[model samples]
Target chain A: MREKIIEKILESGMEFVSGEELSKQLGVSRAAIWKHIKALREEGYNIESVNRKGYRLAERPSDLLASNNICHELDTDIIGKKVISFETIDSTNDYAKQIATNENEGTTIVSEEQTSGRGRLGRHWHSKSHEGIWMSIILKPNIVPYKAPFITLIAGASIAKALNTLGVNTKIKWPNDVIVNGKKICGILTELSAEIERINYVVLGIGINVKTMEFSSEIENIATSLYKEGYNLSRVDVVKAIIKEFETLYFDYIHKNSKLETLKVCRNYSAIIGKKIYILQGEDRELVKCIDINEDGNLIVEKDNGSIKEIVSGEVSIRGEKGYV
Target chain B: MREKIIEKILESGMEFVSGEELSKQLGVSRAAIWKHIKALREEGYNIESVNRKGYRLAERPSDLLASNNICHELDTDIIGKKVISFETIDSTNDYAKQIATNENEGTTIVSEEQTSGRGRLGRHWHSKSHEGIWMSIILKPNIVPYKAPFITLIAGASIAKALNTLGVNTKIKWPNDVIVNGKKICGILTELSAEIERINYVVLGIGINVKTMEFSSEIENIATSLYKEGYNLSRVDVVKAIIKEFETLYFDYIHKNSKLETLKVCRNYSAIIGKKIYILQGEDRELVKCIDINEDGNLIVEKDNGSIKEIVSGEVSIRGEKGYV
Candidate 1:
């Protein structure tokens, strides 16, 4: 009922809707409408009310991540059909896995803060309160377990393309990280529950630093945020753009079995291609030159001995010659 | 404590141990020893109680699956360190997955019957009561997620080699099934919980039809049991052999990063090499000749156009030209 009222107020478009008129249109009592308006204001919605003018929606909370604001004009089929937002959570990926078996495909879980946020390889992710977008999407692709690594590439392509469209030029660091000006701005952590022949569910977790201005000393040299990089974009716009772009690329690859667009975006906007990078595996590190991303989404690299090798995701971490990219 | 009593009784070698001696050796009261003896008897252990000779292990129930029977003289360092047996359960894999995070690396779960057993690709597996070895082993290998599909091959090699050593003459059906006389005698289902970089745990479920005299008509032509093939081996011996063999191969792969022994067994005792097979994917089927098993454990096949291709496991099902192999 609150969503419906918010939708109506949004549809009003700066025009005042009287209490009696709203009650008649929405089939609710005048007292009930007033109560809902009070609740919406308490939730950070700005509403102006006059004696005779009734109420007008002045502004939506820019920092708030509500379904009414994020999904207002979002265009997607299955990616964000249902939005679940939280002020605080342990980890979006963990919560997604708990409900993945029963949740619908593309049901998204988002939070403003994470107490125990995680990154790839069980690394700790710093997600301060209302500083970034910490979200997870539950996907049930009807592909084999071996085909799942490519989906991480699809997610990287989506994030890179989405940020580029929003005028924040970014590059994907091969498999799962998105970078801007040779520093990390976004990361993707994909987890899977699968059998020998098929995948049960894939929880694609994405963490993007948008409004953070300061970083810890350990990651200050490599980590960055949109606000710190002088791009003052709203979190709502970034989330909406990513969800929309992801749906397009994800649907194309899953339904058509075509990797043309994702591969194109990954190749054109890759941060590591044609660069000298170090591949770190356990205690061993080898410097290799990246050639290209193959059609199967594996990284093709030329070794120091002039030998060519295809590197699959999930086993090794890549780094720039000087520092983390 | 009960396992200790069983071990003591078995060590007595058909000689009766007096109640006072047992109480003194095990540091328990006579009445406590008697209570444990009664509990063991209820669990299908046959104990002979004479007037002066207090207790003797007369016989071990052949149909019973218990930790004492399965782990007695089991020569393995990590595979079967802990054995959990159930008379009836929904599925061993499901139960193993529930405790995989907190459980040790080599914890094994076995059941005499599975009410809701599962096969690959969401298929139903019928596990009759007291007739088969329905078991799942939880492993925490430090390998990446892409390398997990080969573990199924390792399991298949172990089963085939173990049965061959017992004079059963079983052949592996490439990735995950064991065949005898052109029919499937055992099937393996490996499930994984993994991140993009590393695997969390793998539940390796193996179901071997040992003493089933009958199968449903739907699978009668395709599936067969050991007793149906005129080998009346005890399930205990079969389970022990497979576990011992699996421990050897599993440790070799996880510790040494060697697939040499597993690949050798798979190629030596393969059922599909040098034969015409049908690759089934959805509603499409293609007849291809099985050329060889590659170094990566992939199936090298010659298509109809004489083009050779490498077929990875987990996406397609292979069948004999006539029927299931």
Candidate 2:
């Protein structure tokens, strides 16, 4: 009832609707409407009321992450059909995995903060309170387990393209990271539960630093955020754009088996192509030149000995010539 | 305490041990010893009491699947360190996955019956009560996810070698099936929880029809049990031998990064190596001649046009010339 009342006020376009009119429209008593208005105010919605007038939605809470706020006008068919918003969580991916068997594909889990965020390869991800987009999407693609690694590339391309669409220039750092100005801004962790021939579920966890300005000394040299890079954007807009872009690319690849658009975005907006990089494998490091990503999404590189090599995504890590990119 | 009492009785080697001696040796009262003996008898152990002599072990219940019976003189360091036995379960793989994160690498879960056993590619497996070995082993190998499909081959190799060692001629069907006389006697289902770069755990489910004399009409043509095939082996011996053989092959692969032994067993005792088989993909079938298994455990086949092609395990299913293998 409260959301319906808020929706009515929002649809009225800042014009005050009389209480009797609202009661007639929403099929509620005038007293019930007043009570809902009061509750909405307490929830940080600045609803304004005047004498001989009724409620008008003056402003919405910018910091609050609610389903209504994120899914208000989101234009996506499947990516964010059901948005589960949280104030804080241990990890969105952990929560998604717990309900993955019961939830439908494209069920999105978002939180304002994560107490124990996780990165790729069992690394700790620094997710402070309300400073970034800590989210996970439960996907049940009808593909085999061998085809799951490419979803991470689709997510990377989506994030980079979404930020660029929002006027914040970003580039994809190969398989699963999004970077801006040669600094890391996003990371994707893809986990799978599968049998030998089929995939049960995939939890695609994405963490993007949006409003974070301060970083610990350990990661300050490499880690960055959109706000720190002087591009201020709202989290809701960024998430909506990403979902829209992801749905298009994801559906194209899964339904049609076409990687053209994602490959185009990845190649055009890549940060490491034609650059000197170091491939790190445990205690061994080798200098290699970035070539191009093949149709199978594997990285093609040229070694210093003038030999070409194709690198699969999960086998090693790549870095810029001097530092992390 | 009950298991210890049974161990003591078995160690006596058909001799009787008095209650007074058992109390002194095990530091329990005679009444407590008597109570444990009574409980053990209720659990289907055969113990004979003679006048003036204590209790002598007559026989063990062959139908019962307990840790003490399966682990009796089981020579393995890492495969069966912890054995959890159940009378009934939905699926041993499901139970193993539930405790996989908290349990050790080689913790094993076994059940006498599975109400809802599963096979590869979301197929249903029929596991009758008290007639088969329905078991799953949880392993946390420090290998990447791409290398996980070969573990299914390792398990198949182990089952074939163990059955061969017991004087029953069996052959491995390339990846994850064991057959006797060109009919499947065992099936393996390997499930993995993994990230892109590392494996979290693998639930290796093995179902061997040991004493089944009947099968549903749907699968009777392609499925047979060891007893039906005239082997007539005890379930206890089969389980112990498979565990011992699995421990050796698993350690060699994960520790030494060697696929030599597993590939050797798979090739030497293969059922489809020199036969014409049909590779089924959805509704399409192509007849191909089996050439060999490569070092990576992929099947090599020769097409009708004399062209050689490599087939990965999970991408397609292989069948005998006319029916399921």
Chain A TM-score values for every predicted structure, listed in order: 0.89, 0.89
For residues A1-325, write the lDDT of model 1, one tens digit per residue. Answer: 7767877788888888899988998899999999999998987889889898888888877767777678777888899888888878999999999999999999999998999999987899998878899999999999888788888999999999999999998998988689888889988999999986788999999999988888899988999999888898888898999999999999898999999999999999988899999999879999999999998899999998999999888777889888885
- C-alpha displacement of A289 in model 2, angstroms? 1.5
Q: Is the docking of candidate 1 incorrect, acceptable, medium or high quality?
A: medium
Pairs that collide in candidate 1 are none
Off by over 4 Å in 1: A1-43, A48-57, A303-307, B1-42, B51-56, B303-307
State the fnat of candidate 2 relative to the true structure. Answer: 0.81
Quality of candidate 2 docking, DockQ: 0.73
